[model samples]
Target: MTPDLADGGAASAAPSPAAAERAARAPLMSVRNVTKVFGRDVVALRGMSLDVRQGDFISLLGPSGCGKSTALRLIAGLSNPTSGRIEWAGGGRTDADLGVVFQEPTLMPWATVAKNVWLPMRLRGKSFASCRADIEDALETVGLKGFEGAYPRELSGGMKMRVSIARAMVTRPKMILMDEPFAALDEITRFKLNNDLLAMRAKLNCTVIFVTHSVFESVFLSDRIVVMAARPGRVIHELNVDEPYPRAEIFRTSAEYAAQCRAASEALNEAMGGAGAGHE
Candidate 1:
């Protein structure tokens, strides 16, 4: 769970140097000086280095084609980086405990929501009887408790996404890699899911690496936002969000939030080669 915010709505005090050093040594997952090249001509990631601490909510924000999805794919072990190494805390290369959610729900249309959510566990040779309790709990956690028997064709986009999230959580993953999971939802649904996601994160305490193009979403959801450049995707800036979790709607309208959003926009603009130029 997120550390409780101290009084005055600031992040808790930084850990002691020794503790920080120890944490630096203990990465749930570390992308160490990684690089990915699509072909002889195109470079996707250029020596990107990031340490994802346990339970962190880090967002990679950039323009389209900035390698954000590529980064997630590498971390998911769906694709290998052309160069550099990814080290897990317990020391291994491939992904065994990670959960991934793509932009689309990718649910089997013929299956009930409960059955869809149970697919991951079923693939691991566990029976429905063995995971029935977990399935119910996961559905409830994602706010789809009563819709278990509903089919994908009967659910709206937001509801389908909720099912996708439930499936990702059912396995109790150590980390979740989400690639613009809410990009297709309507504004109201998007905001609702954003709030729900934060609440779920607080309760589950799983590390999240979310990819998004929305500056506001990144500012509202992230503990740290990594802005990346497009042409050979690389981290241009790392912005720390000091706001406490369970942030109120009032905080969204506050000057502090606006300032952070503006900073992120500026960083994005610069990454997109618009330094000193107006941003959209």
Candidate 2:
């Protein structure tokens, strides 16, 4: 359940020292001048750059051809950038350090939910029996406690997506990349998942880079929204929601949310017009 925030922010008068310290620290990851070009004439992304700090919920909000997924794939190391680089504050990246959830649930049809969630660990030579407790805990966290033995076909679209999220989170990576994980669900389900996702992030303190086509979803879920342009896709503007997390339905209906939506909408319009890509 979402906790009621009295003022919609500031559970207390003064910010905690931990909060201040987190704010002061450097970004956890930096994408510097990254551009992705597919064969001869296709350019999926160009000169894209952004910083991802720990505990951030950033949404890459853009249109059809804006390369949002391409950016995510690049960050996940599924594809290499044509130019520029992605740098981690600590060191180089390894498969174990990142988690990725695509728009599709992408669970194995023949496998049980627990088996699917255990795949990552199993790939690292950990036996399914050995990871049973971790798998059950992840399923419980995602509200799928007793459905472990169920298969994907037995679950609803939303439930399947929850299983997908559980699989991504079971490893407890420092960062998670979601490429429209909730886009296929119905509005009611999406809203429910949105709330659950924030709650999960709060519990895990994981950095999230989300890609979304909906301005409302972006504004509702993100601490920062990066608006992108097409025609060799790139970022044109970035807007900070600057709102506190664990935000409830009340925040969705608040005047502040409305204003933020308007700003994001306007930015989207400009991006579609091919506004010059902006810089930090």
Q: Model-by-model lDDT, in order?
A: 0.83, 0.86
lDDT by residue for model 2 (24-64), tens: 75678999999999997799999999988877888999988
Candidate 1: residue 1 lDDT (0-100):
12
> How many steric clashes does model 1 contain?
0
- How many angstroms is residue 179 displaced in model 1 relative to the true structure, after the best TM-score fit? 0.2
lDDT of 1: 0.83
Candidate 1 Cα outliers beyond 4 Å, as residue runs: 1-26, 93-96, 275-280
TM-scores of all predicted structures: 0.89, 0.89
Extract clashing residue pairs from model 1: none
Tell me the tens digit of each residue's lDDT in model 1 across 107-131: 9999999999999899998899899
